[model samples]
Target: MLKYKLVSRANPRKRNEKQFYAQLTGVQTIKRCDFLSLLEKRSSMSSADVKSFLDALEFELMHRLANGISIRLGDLGSFRATIRSVGAVNKKDYDQRKYIKGVNVRFRPSAKWMREKSKTGELISFETVGKA
Candidate 1:
């Protein structure tokens, strides 16, 4: 049976709107727990710790991008700053001069994720009740 069906069976009235929304949004909402509780759950660390780690990683990537460096996250893709020259046209001789003042950015994903995503074929569609 589908996961949603199981959930609906367990709660016929579906009183948990928050849980339903979280499921639809594809985001997990973990409850707050102590370090010992996390260890007991075999998670290695608390949810707060995991969130902090992700924030730190994002900050580091932003810093690298600011310094004009490309960051490649494994299984993700590649990010890099692209520098291009914009030319200025002179009305007198119609001569064009190129000026360079590049922009910094970041790229991630290492091709493996793309291959995996391609294997999924096409996406399934669903209908929304009140939307035409």
Candidate 2:
């Protein structure tokens, strides 16, 4: 379940006009150690083993992404490095310092994640927790 609060936000175009919207409130974050411990219990491997594997996986992902490779991680998702830059008229006129801003990783959720249904409503449900 997700907890949300009603927030009054002003419109960017019209600052005087405001409307209420649901904003995510107090989302809990699971740290690396805590997540590793949970994974350790679910698998036969120890926490240290899981941590080592995760470290190696991170390295591999970074290396592959830097080399313009998109990786599909089973049912979880696929990740690819995307360029956030300005357009250039010609390839020869394109300059990395001016045209290329930065690179960002993009994740596309799997079909299972996109279209999961449960007996109780949806896979994820939200609850209102008053105004913000």
Find the candidate with the highest TM-score and give its number: 2
How many angstroms is residue 18 displaced in model 2 relative to the true structure, after the best TM-score fit? 5.3
Leading candidate by lDDT: 2
lDDT of 1 by residue, 18-67 (tens): 23221232335565445435645676766666667666887997788777
- What's each prediction's TM-score? 0.43, 0.77
lDDT of each: 0.54, 0.89
Tens digits of per-residue lDDT for model 2, 1-132 = 878999989988899999888988889999988988998999999888999998999999999999999999987789999999999999999999999899999999888776774335477788999856
Give lDDT for model 2. 0.89
The window of 10 residues in a row where model 1 has the poorest summed lDDT is 1-10
Q: What clash pairs does model 2 have?
A: none
